[model samples]
Target: MSTPVEQAFRDHWGRVLAALIGFLGDFERAEEAAQEAFAIAAERWPRDGAPDHPAAWLLTTGRNRAINRIRRERALAAKLPLLEPPRPQADQPAIPDERLELIFTCCHPALAVEAQVALTLRTLGGLTTEQIARAFLVPEATMAQRLVRAKRKVKAAGIPFRVPEGETLRERLGGVLAVVYLIFNAGYSAPPAQGELAAEAIRLGRALAELLPAEAEAHGLLALMVLHDARHDARVREGELVLLADQDRSLWDAERLAEGRALLERALALGGRGPYVVQAAIAALHAQDPPDWPQLAALYGELARLTGSPVVELNRAIAVAEAEGPAAGLALADALPLERFHYLHATRGELLGRLGRDAEARDAYRRALALVHDDAERRLLERRLAALG
Candidate 1:
């Protein structure tokens, strides 16, 4: 059974950590202080039965711990930066302006975008490096190295860890959006080893939406995460990738689908849009359907217009095939980036098999299967290849 205090601790740590950084004005020290607070909680909380306001208690304890460390080191008169009040001491439970600044600092353009996403997931969302790596489909070692390099760069540059003002905001917004989307993408595309990386991304996106409610892009992202996650349970069979058409719509998460549709509606109403919102609008159509391929096709058309990304075009091609017929999808998919891309080849192979192009489909499936890692995906590709034989 999951303990409430442990749940609260994990859920609230990101925001509390953010607030601490805002107050302390340094990432490394703020993390140390937060760690100390957790240690204290482990020792005292069970006896005290969880303070009425756990977040405040944690924050207060963390800040106090920082002070003790400063004093113990005899830096009391050395003129160090004091912890600025991040949110009122007793009233609102939200983080202060400093937390916002911290977001901006992490979202800084100087940091590689992968590093930005990885760091945000780690520090802001409390995800481990292994989690981040799995989401990105990279090795854990590579992700760890990337994160270490990013931290070193941030320290070396001495980039002020705070939110940016109006003029600079637009320039930084792209990077911020990219990082957020990167997290979402990782969750959306998790390996079989993880229960639901997609769920993790949605959680992070939802948190960001809460922290920045007025930001249309944030809602757009939330909308997208929910829509994708809705299909997760039925997207695969007993160790096989069930193509969308083959998936059992009855198994889709209805509640999450409804919630995602509502978020997309709100996101669309916000109007001041970007690629994520536009892509979400496309996904919203999918979220509402019992696999109505035509509606999905229209959405793909809209999305293709929003961002001419090759990936989007590839998706659009698939949508076109779904709305029309396998022949149409095959032509479109073939013309796109099909080479060295497992999904493209796998898709084309499936289409060709339907078209009675047995030899060609078998070859395509072989190539596609060679590139795929997930067991379920591999099984499906092999099944298709066997069927062709």
Candidate 2:
């Protein structure tokens, strides 16, 4: 079992790094300094006992270490003249929370979407380059280069290390939320053996919601994550994927589901009708016994209109099937331009099987099996194909 101090380090690593970056105004330097501080903590905490406020201690230590390193490097000192050492003083006022600022900076529109997501996972989510690369199915060196380039652009282009306001915040908020969802999806879709990217994303979502409590979309995103992750325990069994309907409902986290419902209610009350809110509402419907599939289909239709996403439409088709019949769902799925999407084919296969078109269903399942990446999903498809005989 990990010690409390060790757990605190894992939880607050991003916060400490964000604070250091704000103080030092250099991404690489801040990360290095934060790492050094944690290294020191590893050595000293066992001897000195853990501090009452580990995050604050880590931030202060990281800042001091950064200042000293700058002092020692004459070239670095010349480059960063504004980073003069702080004078010893009595308890200073608390540093403002800079994690939001850091995330906004990472998700700047100037960066590509992939880079923005990768950088956010690294800087704000505290994921290593290798871990992020693995999550995205990219090579380690490629991810490392991507992070390097992102940081270089941030420095060279002088992206402001502060949160935007008004219209700017509105424009940038979408990218940040997209990146968070991407992180969650990565964790949600990965094999059971991988890390919990979903939990990390949910934690980040909670932080974003707390930081911008008035932002309905933030709450919506958090609700969506909480609702989806509540099913994490039920999503798989015996190392195989388990469809939602087939999952043992008892395995679902009741507290998380309740929390998600409360968040959805709060978001709706805030007059949020955005895509995330709509999706969360759909998830809320699913949590119900004898789900309101008509309402779910309607919400998905609204989401499809808001986002113009074929995936949402495909989901809507599934809802339509549940509300109407498999044939209606198959018709909707057939019209979609998702030939390469494995889930689309898998869904079609199920609908076809339900309609007793075994031959077509078997072919559809084969197509899905060919395109599917996850072994568990592929196995499910294979089983469906075999059932056709």
Candidate 3:
């Protein structure tokens, strides 16, 4: 029921903001100008009708607004030394799509991981501070401060607002991929309240994949997200969480699954077998009916080796349980230092339950319930605990 103008604004806000930041070379000023342009559009669009290229219109308006604001406020003007006048109509493209540069800037290695994720969601994902905070289960005020500090750091450090090249790009690409996947996971794991975030993250991933088609990890990340998102419908049922093995396959999105498979194939074809690619391959295996557990276990072994992540080892334990036995899986799980991760406990509970170690399983489920924050996941752990009784 949303209007075309609303839809356009939602879709193009990041591109407009990215172009503005590239032009203005100041995040605060660029954001303010972009917001002002949107405000004007909110008033004018209903009357003038939406423009053929709404993003282009927004970029032009935002640039003009920044120029006017700079001229009016001397104090503000001093901070920005290189304000260029609005280019003549024929001299410039409608809107320069510099989102890649914007993403790299937001995901700079100098920034903390949390700040990188927050700033990328805000600037490139067009997510509100409140939305980002809610997604991460943090306070709005705290998230706002984090964003402010990150922006100030970018300016103070003079982090270039352009994409890096050669080895530099390779060095920075990991951070960028991590930020994108974090956004996707935030959206994927939360309940319906933040479902749109998952879709937004996927859109960002698709854009990244298209922009850097040669990068195997980019394609791997996109495939991983798409494959995982394909199960969104099956992940929940009648307001309750559904375990993967119990999910109704009919509810899984076929198109998204196919898309993910195709992307995985492409990434593999590129001969890039990074952690993301291996993870995507694991996800693809899971999408199968009676998933190839032996293959999944092998892939998880590769993944754990690639990332040296205890979480991946925990996942590998699950696959090992299926391919071998619950006792074997429990042995592997016990070796991991995953005391703080809720899923580890949950997996341990499931494995112990399968092995008829009900008392230990009950204890694991209780621990998981205490650690888990999500309502659905807590409910699931409680259900498991109740089943033991």
Best by lDDT: 3
Candidate 3 lDDT (Cα, 0 to 1): 0.89
Cα lDDT over the full model 1: 0.75
On residues 1-389, what C-alpha lDDT tens digit does candidate 1 reach at each position? 76656776667777778878767766777888988887788888788777777787788888888878877888877735564433445444543434456667777889877788887877777777897787677999999898888777777898777667676866676677677667666555555665455555666677667767777888888887788788888886775678776788899989988988889888878874677787777776665555567776776767777776666767777787777888998888888855777988888887888888888888888899889987877887887788786
Clash totals for all models, in order?
A: 4, 0, 0
Model 1 is weakest, by summed lDDT over 10 consecutive residues, at 83-92
Name the regions of candidate 2 deviating beyond 4 angstroms.
Answer: 75-81, 84-93
Candidate 2 global TM-score: 0.92
Q: How would you order the candidates by lDDT, starting with the best?
A: 3, 2, 1
- Every candidate's lDDT: 0.75, 0.88, 0.89
Tell me the tens digit of each residue's lDDT in model 3 across 1-389.
Answer: 98766786778988999999998888999999988988998899899898777887888889888888887786664755676666664235466789999999999999999999899889887788998899888999999999999999999999999889999998899889988888788788777788877888888888898888899999999999999999889988888999989999999999999999999999999987998899899999999999999999999999989999999999999999999999989899999998999999999999999989899999899888889998878888888889888
Q: TM-score of each candidate?
A: 0.86, 0.92, 0.90
Error of 1 at 93 (Å): 5.5
Candidate 2 on 1-389: residue-level lDDT in tens?
A: 99866797668987888988888898999999988988999999989898777887777888888877876876674756676555442254355479998999999999998999889889888888998898888999999999999999999999999999999898889889998998888888887534468878998999999998988999999999999999888988998888888889999899999999999998998999998889899888998888999888899899999999999999999999999999898899999999999999999999999999888888898899889987777788888788788
